[model samples]
Target: MAKDISVPFSYTKDGIYYFERRVPRDLQKHYSASKIAYSLRTRSSSVAASRATRAAQQLDEYWYHLRIKGSELPGKHLLRMQQNATKAPGSLLPSEHDDNATVSQSEAVAIYLRLKGQNRPVTFHRAAERACGYVIDVCGDKDLLGYSKADATRFRDAFIERKLTGSSITRIFGTVRSVVNLAASEVGVNITNPFTGVYYDRQSGVIERAPLPADVIKAVQRECMKIDDDLRWLVALISDTGLRLAEAAGLLREDLVVDADIPHVVVREHPWRRLKTCTSARVVPLTGMSL
Candidate 1:
C-alpha cells in the first residue's frame, strides 16, 4: 500500500484503513466518546482516500448546521397566525370535539398572548412571541404534542450555538414553557411541556457584577455633593436610593413627595418605562445629598 496524502486515516499492519476524528469541544457532550472512529474496511489507498474525503465533508456540513441551528430565520413570524382584535380566550384553540385537531407552535403563541396578554405591556407580548418564534425558526411549527425530549435538547443546543447568555436562554425557555402549557390546557389536550427540565448552564458565560465598596461609594457621593449640579444630582440620587437608571430617569414629578414626614420617591410603572419586577415598584426614602 502506498502512502497517500489525501488519506486522512490510520492503517493497521493487517492493511485495514480506519477513520478517526476528534469531536469538537462544544459538541462533545452530544457523543459518548471524545473521538469518532470507524473501520473503512478498504485495503486500497485510493478507495480509502475517497471514502475519507466524503466522510469528512459530511461531518463538516453536519457540524456547521449544529453551530448555526439557532440563527435567526427571516420572516419566521410569518408562520404565526395574525392577531384577531376580538378573539376571546380559547378561540384560537382547537375545538373540544375535534379530537383530530392539533395545536402548532404558532397557534400556541397566539393562544398564550390572547389569554395572558390582557392589559399587559407590549414587552410582555413581544417576549412570548420572540421565544415561540425561535422554536418555529429552529424546529418548524410542529404540533404541540409532536415535540419530544430530544427536540427540547436540540432547542437548548441551538441557544448555546447562538451564544445567548444563560439567563437569557432560561427566560426564553420559561416563556416557551408557559405558551405550551397554556395552549395544552386551554385546548383540553393532555400533553407535557417539552421545554421543562432541559438543563443548560444557567450561569455559563455570565460575568457577575460586584457592588461598589463602601469607601468607593462614599467617595463618589462626596464628589456629587461638592458639585451638586443637575448631572451629579442624578448620580447622587442613584447612589443614595439605589434606583435603577431607567427607574430614576423616568420618575414623574409627582413621584417626589418631599413634604411628607419621610421624604421619598415613588418608584412605579409608567407608560414610558416599566418596573424591572413587581417588587421594584416601591417607595425609597430620600437621604444624604439626594434631598
Candidate 2:
C-alpha cells in the first residue's frame, strides 16, 4: 500500500493510479496538447509504478525521434544534389504523382515493420524508422529501385559528416538494408538493396568501455553491504552474477536455482523486458552476496 516515490502517480477516487507529464517547451509545437496524461488502469501501486516507468520511457524515445526528424542532417544540401545527379534518366522521386512507380523507401519501412515487428521490442521499430528517415532527410524518399550504390555511399558520408561513430553508422545501414531487402522480397521485386555492403570504418571514433578495477568492484560491494538496502541488494546481485540491470530486475523468484548443485540464475527475456542480444539468455553462476 506504500507509494513508490520514484514514479510519479496520482490516485483517483476509485483508487486508480494515473500519470501526467508536461511536454518540454521546444517539443510543444509537435503536439496540439501541452501535456500527456494517461490512466495506468491499476489500483496496485507496484503495477502502477511499472506502467508509469514504461510510459515515461516510451515518451522519451518518441520525443527523441521527433527531434531527430526535425533537425537537418549534416551536408544534406550537398548529399541531395549528388543523389539527384546519380539518379537514372527516368527515375522519379516519391512525390504526389509517383505512387505507382514502385514501393518507396518510406513505404518499404512500413511494409518491413508490418511484417517483422510483431512481438518485437520498441527499439526494433524505431531503428527501422530512424534509419530510413535519415536517408529520406538526406537524399529524398525515392522508389526502392531508384536508390543506387551512390546513394548508399552518400548516406554513409552524411553520417560521417555528422560525426557519428563508425559503429553507429554501420548499424543504421544495417537497418536500412534489412528494410529494403524485406520489402523487395515481399513484393517479388528483383532490385538489389543498395544499402548492402556500403563500406565504413567501423572503429572510427569508437571508445571501448573499460571494466571496473577489481579493487573498485570489491569496494563497491563492501559499501553496498554497509548500506544494506533494496537498491544495494540489486547492486550486489549484479556484481556477483554479472547480470545486466534489466536482466536481474526482470528475474522471477523461480529463476534462482539455489537448491541445485551449482547455485545459478537463469537470464532470459520477459514480456516486460527484452534481452539486448539473441545470445543474452544464459545461466549465470551466483557467488558472494548473490548466492
Candidate 3:
C-alpha cells in the first residue's frame, strides 16, 4: 500500500492549523530557530494544505537564502513572513517596484551589491565594482534608462585603449550588463538592454590549462601512502575526490558520512567558509580511494 504522506508539514492545535519543520541537522548552527512554527490561521483542511504548502516552500527559500548569505535574510519580506505567518504565505516575495529605469548608474551598482554581496567572496564583490566603475567613468552619472548605445560603445573603446584583450572586455561588459538586466527584471526598470547585440573581439587572452597526467596522479598517490599526516590525506583526497582544494580542506567530521549505503561528502556553507555558488553545494558519492 502507498503510504499516507498527506499534509506533510502541518499540524493542528485548538482547531487552528500550524506549519512546522525541523532545520536540517547540518544547517542547525546557521539558524537561530531550530524548528520553525507558525499559525497558518485556517480551520479548513484544504485551506490549511494550501497555506502550508506555500509556507513550506517559503521556508525552503528562507533556508536557502540563509545558507546563501550565511544567516542573513535576503530580503525584508522573508523576515516579515517568518515573523507574521498569519499573513498569506506567498506575500513573502520582495516588494515590487517599477522604478528601476530611473535608478542612476551608481545607485544601480549599490542595489546590485545589496542583492548579491551578503556572503559572496570579497573578490566577487570587487569584480562587480571594477566592472561597473569602468562604465560609470566612461558614461558619466546617468540613470540606467539614460545610458545610450553610444555610452556602451565608448565603454568598449575605453577598454580597447587600455590594451585589454577582447575576452577581458567581454567579461566586463557581461558583468555590467548583468546588473542592468537584474535591475530591469526585478525592479521594473524600463530598458531595452542597451548592451544587447553589441559584439566585441573575443579571440585574445584565452589561456588553456589542462588536467594532470595519469602518471602524476599515480606518483602523488604513492607519496600520499608514504606519509601518515593530514597533509597526506589532503593530497590523497584531492587526487581522488576531484574536489576544490578549499572545499576538501574545510570538511569537518560532521560532514562525512561513511556508513550510509552510499558514502558521500556533503559540501555546505560553514561559519568559516562559503560555497562559491549554490550549484557548488552538493553531495559527491564516495568512489575509488575516496571511500
For candidate 1, give the lDDT of residue 171: 94
Per-model lDDT: 0.76, 0.72, 0.69
RMSD of each: 14.2, 16.1, 20.4
Candidate 1, residue 122: Cα displacement in angstroms equals 3.1
Clashes of 2: 0
lDDT per residue (tens digit) for residues 1-291 in model 1: 333456875444367777667778986544446776665657778888876776667557656765687211112232223343244444566777889676878777777776788878878977987888678656767889999999899999988986889999999999999989988888888887789999999998899999999899999989987987878888988998889999999988999999999999999999888888889989999997677
For candidate 3, what is the total of clashing residue pairs? Answer: 1
Worst 10 residues of 1 by lDDT: 70-79
Judged by whole-model lDDT over C-alpha atoms, candidate 3 comes out at: 0.69
If both were scored by TM-score, which would come out higher, candidate 1 or candidate 2? 1
As a TM-score, model 2 comes out at: 0.65
What TM-score would each prediction reach against the true structure? Answer: 0.66, 0.65, 0.59
TM-score between candidate 1 and the true structure: 0.66
Residue 106 alpha-carbon offset, candidate 1, angstroms? 0.8
